[model samples]
Target chain A: MLVSTARLHSVLKTAVDGIIVIDDSGTVLVFNDACVHLFGYERDEVIGKNVSILMSEDDAKSHDAHIKRYLDTGEKRIIGQGREVSGCHKDGSPIPIELSVGEADTSEGHQFIGIIRDLRARKAFEQRVRDLQSNLVVMTRVNALDEMGAAIAHEINQPLTAVMLYLQTAARRMKTLEEQDPQLLSIMTRAVDEADRASKIIQRMRSFVEKQEPQKVGVNLASLIDECVELVMLGHKNDNINVISNFSDHDYNLTVDAIQVQQILVNLIRNACEAIKDCKKQEVYVDVDIAATDVFIKVTDTGPGLCEEVREQLFKAFTGTKRRGLGVGLAISRSIAQNHGGDLFVEPYVKGKGATFVLRLPLGLDGADGQSNLASASMI
Target chain B: MIHVIEDDFSVRDALQHLFTELGASSCTYSDAESFLNFLKQVTAKDCVLVDLHLPGISGVEVIKYLRELSDPPHIVAITGKSLAEINKAFTGIKRPPIVRKPLKEECLLREMDLGTALNSA
Candidate 1:
């Protein structure tokens, strides 16, 4: 019996999943090595504590009643089967776990042995898959809109071409006539001007829809951000806004379309500058942070932060709070970011603080296939 | 002489009228096959405005055939397609000056003059 207990202890200590044994009074009897690691506590710290200490607040409140009910009714709820549950770490953060509980009648009384497997990594992987699937759907819809825009531009441009030519031809003929009417000439000129304006609108629409394949090349992240900041500051030379750049210690090298990425940076920096133009704080913060799979470029301003209503419409085409231009800048910027397997979003607004916009780009070249298809569709 | 090859009737007529007003003698064709069939050879003194999209034979093929002649005409590409499309179609070849539609009068006149000057030279 002594040899058997030592071997059992060794097995519990070496198991990959956490194992814990609790007595009838809910006191932890055995806390294995894996259990110590999973709970962020040492075996000595948890061995004799109430098992309820490892449970979430609500779970702890009902755990004792559950044990008593099961003991009295001889009923089993989770005693024989595995199910997902939340465990409270020593630091008080909830940890997702798959737990299976079993009971054994011993000389000391009934004891429960619980085995737990951490589900954090698997849950994160599942969430990432769901996000990618949704991104693919958005990209498909954007591509269809690009194709329809191209067709519309082509069909309408032909008629506009003919109309402009006819109007200019009429005006030229009038100039050649012996008796030219000044009012007719003026009216013809105005008509020609309107046609020109219409043509320009079409050109703008075409440009918005035009999909040029991203010429991705390796570039230093610091230098790119510096260049973009300089470009933006040049336009605001007279403004008193303070621009601060914070780059992480590690030098990041990213493969991206430099010009497109630069466009997004310039727009973001310029928007931040404009936001704080009238504010007393007059500051813009540009920060670059690196993660394992992606890099984030955050632009924070000192202006009035975005409200709920404006934030909702911030990324939609033709909707913006600014009085000067159509709000397609953010919309186009977001699409460009998405095409490169990245994302652009406004951070949650805080009252009395400036808004923050984050541009996230994947470090790897994984979205090349979707981008190429978009390029072809837009070109057509 | 200026030759206009366009599948669209209204555009072709307007271009013809515009070239006439500019005092340049011009001829028009609706497709590449007709133009190639009619014009056995083109000289350095001539200029051609060819739409990149044509009905029977593609404008790219016509441009290629024209380029092979001993003295090819000065060719200008006109298209409603985006610049990216044009660049892709003309990859690996020396691209000609492109005029996008709806055509700007000044842009057309300038390209026409440049073509005529280059051809005559």
Candidate 2:
């Protein structure tokens, strides 16, 4: 029985954990293999040394008092139930550990045994995950703020210029005429110039926020729709939900903001997926048809049609029906379409069917202005 | 005569001084309620320069209130918030004029049909 007991003790010593035993006088008695691995000290080096030697500065200060009290008063504090404690490694890294200690009373007096579970790796991983999540959220909010800054730049730029021209005209008139003809010909002109700068900044911001690789070269509506659907599926689609796309052959291209267009498609697809979450079919259908004058891409979800309330402010910013999101997706999408001399609309799907979002852009990509589509093709 | 409705202190402060300097007779209100109260009593041949976004009430409602006036002056929706809001303001009132800000003196002069200051309101 004594030999078997010795064999079992040796087996326990090699197990993956820090196991330690101390005599009633607090002299070291047992130190296991795992303890050596954790502290980077051999048994011969640590077995006779004081336990406090293995603790961090803060841990050692309190541990000194704890052991002194137990020895003096025969009172137990943390020597029974396991408590989370910090351990200091040889390399000076702090390791989190759960320690359980108990006393073995014999004719001589009592000894204490401790079991410590290391949690350094797990805590490190959790911290890394939290840091990444925090960074992602911060970036997304900044992107939204930046996007609005751009939108305002476009709208305010023109009137600002006209205002400036009026200023210069008034300045000349003021010198030539008697009365103050809005002393702002120069001021208005400056405001317009500044507004133009603001618009450029806005465009730059949009480009910065969505810096994903541009799908340049003549991209057809069919291919764009497919790409969008694929992206949505990666995030939201699953075994229960499927998406079907029907695209028409389009031979033309638009001098379009392809990144902006993809953004719209993603929003629409996401909106559709969210809409049909609990429906039976749980499928979203995207149908693309290219006309001689326009290109139409419609997204239909099997979910119930939009309620009366959602229909009212369908394309308004901040005021949207989505439960999760900036509610600016559709609003931004609509604006991009409008900017491209195109339009995105919400048409009644089938009377009792789902919602249909249609995107229609003018034929020939360069129609938004006299600007060449060649510029767009390069960016694409 | 014009009713200046705005909320952003910095922008509104500049507008108050700008309109006063430009020689347009005006009253300034920081909130929709204060402006509505003043507009109710100030019955005259005056235009309204209102921000589209305001605290307590929307600029759209302000437009509706002006439309109900017995002799409504031209309501010019002035804002620096968003183009969508400007578009909505125009569409809401069937093409009402709008001026967006930094409050340029010439834009204000031209939009308000202000002739030479010698013919002050």
Best by TM-score: 1
Candidate 1 structure quality by residue, lDDT tens digits, A1-380: 99999999899979999999999889999988888888899988888888999999999999999999999999999998999999999999999999999999999899999999999898885575455345444654564466446656777888899899988888888898999799999999999999999999999988887644676776666767776676677677888977888873324567787767877887899899988888889988899877767889999999999988888888777667678865667877886787676889999889888999999988864533211212121110
Q: Please provide, for model 1 over B1-121, each residue's C-alpha lDDT reduced to its tens digit, 9 standing for 90 to 100.
A: 8888999999999988876766677889999988997566567778888999886688888889988888887888899977666775787988888899999778887776545643443
Query: lDDT, candidate 2, residue B31?
Result: 83
What's model 2's lDDT at A101? 91
List ranges where model 1 is wrong by over 4 Å.
A1-14, A130-151, A170-188, A206-380, B7-9, B17-34, B53-64, B81-95, B113-121
Off by over 4 Å in 2: A71-76, A153-316, A320-380, B1-121
DockQ, every prediction = 0.27, 0.03
Please give fnat for model 2: 0.02
Candidate 2 lDDT, tens digit per residue, A284-364?
888866676777878888888876667768877677655777677677778667655578988853567889899886666
Model 2 interface CAPRI class:
incorrect
Candidate 1 docks at the CAPRI level of acceptable
The complex in candidate 2 yields a DockQ of 0.03
